[model samples]
Target: MPSTVFDIPTWVNPKVAPDRHVQIAKALYSVPGDLIGQRLSARVDAQTVKLYFRGELIKVHPRIAAGRRQTDPADLPSELTAYAMRDLNTLQRRAESHGTHIGIYTAAVLEHPLPWTKMRQVYRLLGLVRRHGADIVDDACRRSLDAEVVDVGVIDRMLARGATGQQLTLLPPPAPSRFVRSATDFAVRRPS
Candidate 1:
């Protein structure tokens, strides 16, 4: 697949002098996980190297602009030039470490949705149960099982009882019928 070029935004300022080694280090660190099976987009200009990991902006090395103000292709820094080759080497190592020899394009095809989305929602509800159902388990036992176990049945039963109680409390009170308007009518009222 053809490589795509990303235009680096002019306003972004780099805090440190960009060294190729440091830039590579920042890039590796900025990535969320072990870079074994991921795709990276690296752009090197006169002043900086910006990396995008899995389509997300990850790191920027500002040292690329240390001596140059103009973005002349001919005046690209030697460090950046060396970094381009070095970055490729690192990418190769990452690929091999992950047991794959494919380039970034091929890796993109293999990426899957993050698992945390499902895990987080389940974790939140489980947390609620743990906080509210403290009486159900001993403190020592709760601590041991907190990270490993989920009590689905207890949560369901608690929720069911709460719903039933609410339904009963919300019921309308009984009202007297118009036909039986007064107690005197039922009592012996003189014929009128």
Candidate 2:
């Protein structure tokens, strides 16, 4: 009998997870952000893993050990690269570039026991800056920080309702009417 080559790569069809990664041999490999929730074919061999989408090669990564992750920052959304890499400073700097208060506000928003969990909120805040302008977002962030609120949704609501903070000045109380007695008038007078 003659010796013959019999090496073949194992093929796997995996669905890209919400995090834009696929598992091969227990190791996680990142895919493009647009591929999330889509099925992809992977060719796994001894040295590398190749991913294909719709029969077209999309990504290739060196095979890693089990319980490890191989992520390419370019494979993730630009806004999410910092989060995926747990680079909190990047987000803070991005926010600060818009405004000092915006940076402080984002830091407050991301100040959690598990800060990565709040990355999406920071992402939303930055998006708000783009949509509503940096000055507007910075104003909202300043107001929110003054109010001790750290919610992106609240800032978004402020922008949606055109809360420029200038129009929120307190108005003087209306003059008392004879018909409406003051609360003190209803109180029983105790004998001295």
Candidate 3:
């Protein structure tokens, strides 16, 4: 009997449970994204594999050596990463294109030190434009800015309550101090 040779495919995208990420060998990889399932294809190279989504290359990883596990941070959405990796200027410009108040609020978000830290909030605000229309988001943003408070949570609540056009109340100014404390007040004194 003639011996038959079997060719084995080296690359694999093992199925994962719902709300879980795909596993490639010991490494976990992202399909289009973790939130939605999408068709993905992987091409094996001598030392790496390229992952594609909708014909667009999305991730690449080096072949896993025995007993080695590799994790690519880029595999996940930027928001899912440890810190939001985004361009503050770009996000601000996009918000500005919507409305002045939105622009101002966006500016505040970016101006805060380490803008990446606040990227999720900025992205949420941007997404609202598609959900509620620019007019409504702009109005909400305007109200938030005028209230002298910029917060996505507050804006989301207002939008949910159909208060986009409602006027926002300004916070009361800080109360006047009745007395000024001097540093000597805390000074230790020897017993008489």
Candidate 4:
């Protein structure tokens, strides 16, 4: 009978911050909030760490160099979504690069009174590009620009039916607001 010997590396237990994240060698790492206050282990690799909580492996990420931090959108706690949504600059740039109309539309949607609320709409519009391919989506967006349509529903319909380029009378745009509105405005005001 013959047996094979396997070498298993060891890990170290460590405490995490209230944000359920830790910094290793100047590189920040996200840990599930639920893991906070519990014994956790960090199995180090040259480029990543296998984070374990309750003896269960949770996250692995490429080692971050000094002065660098990484935050996964999925790691964001529910309560922090609004704060996270505040920065959609990357998505805006992506939408802008896709096409002029898409960029305009994405900007408008993100500018809505409650941009976070409208984020899903933006994602849906972007999903079209994924489904139809970037080139086709760009063509559709070009046609959308020609048709003077910026609404996602209209853009989607046009793409599905191949009517993007053909012009059709669009409804008069709603009166443009002179000022942008933030989520705070919708909060129920209490008379003091």
Candidate 5:
């Protein structure tokens, strides 16, 4: 008796279902590419599989997409270009190794936020950090002293101790990452 090996479908085949395209799109977008206008073409032969990206072809094994699972973009980082490229490579390799076709579309470049908007966000975050700094300092002090002093009490104490504006820094400074998280989290956690 002869042993038999089963062959499965490749990702690049046009025969792949339409729902698979959606799954592929979700998986591809989870990586960091712009999905605007790129096209994917796949071809499979008996021993090797090929995938073409904008006419550039690569060879691989064919069973890459068949046995594996499709991932969602929402579960990945917003910038997923590198991940997408990796997936593409895997698919191509699988195709070539197993004699199947796999086509994957290229994505469009992503647009970054405007400079002014970014600056505004940074300033906003800095403001939040400054506002929260005193509270954080007060909390630390209280914890260190094993007391329950409020931030207002700390401010009052500082004033009573004749700590001038120059001697006691009361103003908050801008911190981009801190402010962004603080502001957003503050809003979300605020009671109605």
Candidate 6:
């Protein structure tokens, strides 16, 4: 028999959300990235919440009121911290690091009443820079911006089709085909 019996605490089995957080008592707490999608054991007390994975303690967070979230930056991927935090300045600076046009394009796309709503587009544009290369994406952004078009899909299509401004600038028009007809061939004469 134990020297003293412990008080029964409230427990919940919560699956980790994609954002690397689990909810307890309507409040959210961060969890290690590796634990995402896995159900965790959470013990709720008066002042703190304790989380367990397979009976091993994994995280601890102070109890917050319902409708609030407590995030420890360490739990998020380094590259995603700015995104999760909705820090537009950080995102814009990252775009600027790629090129002047990319930064301008990012700013254009994010110029919304609710700027945070466009964060995914800016993030996807950054991925395009990684996939196609900064020079190519920068040129595409320049062309799109010049045309007053602020669509990321258009920029991605331009990159996919290799139709960047520099490439277009260096290429000349194709020569007319030998099978082309002369203007006289289609000329109509009055019946005489």
Question: lDDT values of the candidates?
Answer: 0.40, 0.90, 0.69, 0.72, 0.35, 0.91
- How much is 125 displaced in model 2, in angstroms? 1.6
The lDDT of model 4 is 0.72
TM-score of each: 0.21, 0.59, 0.47, 0.42, 0.22, 0.69
Instruction: Output candidate 5 Cα RMSD.
Output: 21.1
lDDT of 4 by residue, 44-136 (tens): 756577888777788887777877876776787865643463557767777888777678778876877767777767778888987777677
Off by over 4 Å in 3: 1-22, 28-46, 50-89, 157-192
lDDT of 4 at 54: 73
Model 2: worst 10 consecutive residues (lDDT sum): 161-170
Clashes of 6: 0
Candidate 3 residue-wise lDDT, 46-134, digit = tens = 56767766577777767665455455556556554443235566677778999888888888877776778888898898888778888
Q: Residue 117, candidate 1: how far off, in angstroms?
A: 4.3
Ranking by lDDT: 6, 2, 4, 3, 1, 5
When 1 and 3 are scored with lDDT, the better candidate is 3
After TM-score superposition, the amount by which residue 117's alpha carbon in candidate 4 deviates from its true location, in angstroms, is 1.8
lDDT per residue for candidate 5 within 117-141, as digits (tens), equals: 2322222322332554434333333
Candidate 2 local lDDT, residue 25 = 91
Model 3, position 98, has a per-residue lDDT of 90
Worst 10 residues of 4 by lDDT: 78-87
Which pairs of residues have clashing backbones in candidate 2?
none
What is the per-residue lDDT of model 2 for residues 76-142, given as tens digits with 9 covering 90 to 100?
9987787779898998899999999999998898788998888889889989988889998999889
Assess the local accuracy of residue 33 in candidate 4 as a C-alpha lDDT between 0 and 100: 57
Alpha-carbon lDDT of model 6: 0.91
In model 4, state the lDDT of residue 28.
74
Q: What is the lDDT of residue 58 in candidate 1?
A: 62
Candidate 6 structure quality by residue, lDDT tens digits, 95-176: 9999999999999998999999999899899999999999989999999999999999998888877843445455687887
Q: Judge candidate 4 at residue 36 and give its lDDT.
A: 62
